[model samples]
Target: MKFAIISVTEQGHKLAKNLLEYLENDPSVIKVDVYHKNVNSTLNKCFEEYDCWVGIMASGIMVRSVCPLIKTKFTDPAVLVIGENGKHVISLLSGHMGGANHFAVKLAGMIGAVPVITTATDLAGKMGLDTLAYQYWLELDHRISIKNINQNIAAGGKVDLYLPTKFDFLKNHPIVNTSYKIDIWNKTFIQASFSGDEIVLTPRRMVAGVGSKKGVTEEQVFFALRSALQHLHLPLSRLDAIATADIKEDEEGIKLAAIKSDLPLMIKSLEEIRNFQHPDCTTSQLVKREFGVGGVSEPAALIEAGDNSRLILKKTAYNGVTVAVAVAI
Candidate 1:
């Protein structure tokens, strides 16, 4: 995710730089662009390019800058305002869907500031499904349903809740008076039915490790990727990210495929991928000769999923492309 850190003074600039250094290495924090002076115009000019905004100035300035750009909480970026002296960080807009509420608490901790949150759901100590969906990287079957749920909760309306399985954390989550019966994880999504403003959240749990020959066509790569996931009883929507060896960074087939589908592509170094081992994954002498690695797909997937990855599917060949699957720990 990207953040636009807007500051007005030298002190604010210092705070912005400090935050950038602190969060620079986090994988989820892709970019933290710092802007000083004329923050309102700059933010007004480039608001869409960022995921969130951190204003290190007066709350009035923040309000004036973001008020004109406000659309809906669902589509707007999460915004937080930190006092110029850095004593308070307030969730200015897009509290839940934009993640400003959660990020406010975190950023406040970094700077010894108090987080000011006015969202009704948060003050009531309830967790809406939309927040969970965003946190888990799950896509809601209907965005409107989640928004409705949050709206009702904010209005002090009582609503019954349901969950398929017990998540230890959700047990104490913001949802009040919810019951559990079945396992949502194992239930077939196609046959499942929910009523009365219930939200359907689809978890993106799969990551595909791909290996392609030089000059592979995007058509062949897409066909092979979809076919592999279908065999595993999962759909393309459930695919989280794409993984491949860094050596294939210039490979247009997978690059274009990821762009076309709008998936996060993780390309690890050849040595990093080769350092890991999969019991069932095959190592080609030919591949080792050209790329200094025995296999690309499986190991790349494993590395992308980190050390605690559980391999679900081994290398499966399709034409000139190979595919693998792993779940992160």
Candidate 2:
């Protein structure tokens, strides 16, 4: 994952540099972009390009600068703020559920800073609702679901435990309320009151369709991908994988989108699409000739039939550039 660290002080710069080095050596962190002192000026440029942001400055400034971006809700990248002296590192937003809290704790340990983890369930060493949702690949409609679940759990209310199979954690946890006869597929958990020990179980699957123009940079591609997902009312994390034509092999945007999304880009060749025998399909000769590959045909062939899908967004021009989405069914 890519990261951007902003620090103003000389000491902060040194610390940021050291952190960059540490992240560079770690396999999980693919890149670290350090921006010291002039964070406000560079914020816009760096915001959409990275997976996480670490600000070594006053908490107030961190909050202010990040607030606008947060309001936009483009993507939930882990945002953290560390003290200038490395005394503390706090996850301001997108904590464990977004994988930010976990990243903060790891960074704190490496730098010998105090990880001021404030998430109640995490501090209590109990299962966090958001974390649980992440583990099960479930997407909550709102952040209030997490708050409500945590509040109920803290108050000692029993929560329903719904899983495909019984696990040792569920067996041992005191708050787990389980029923062997319950079938999760047919039951909806929307109106179920939280007893603090119960959790609804459900399967998850999503696809992210990415479109790119020739010479499209990674940053541009990311913006398009984010806009497309937002238009479709889908979260980036929910995307299971990306589908595109084989010709995008050299497209930087396509490559980076796959990496940042942590989803494999399944590229289909022309022959593969030609062999697909779907009667409702429409072939695009212009697209084939232009891209030297069939963009729509490949994505359609790769997706399962009868699955409801929509075209979330058409190509939106940005500074004379265009991008589009091709969601599948």
Best by TM-score: 1
Question: Per-residue lDDT tens digits of candidate 2, residues 273-296?
Answer: 545553233345666687544445
Candidate number with greatest lDDT:
1
- Lowest lDDT sum, 10 consecutive residues, model 1, at 184-193
Query: Model 2 — which ten-residue stretch has the worst lDDT?
Result: 177-186
Give candidate 2's root-mean-square deviation (CA, Å). 12.5
Where model 1 places Cα greater than 4 Å from the true spot, the runs are: 145-148, 151-185, 188-195, 205-329
Please, what is the TM-score per model? 0.59, 0.54
Give the alpha carbon lDDT tens digit for every residue of 92-122 in model 1: 9888778898889878888788999997777
- For each candidate, the alpha-carbon lDDT, in order, equals 0.73, 0.60
- Model 2, stretches more than 4 Å misplaced? 72-75, 166-329
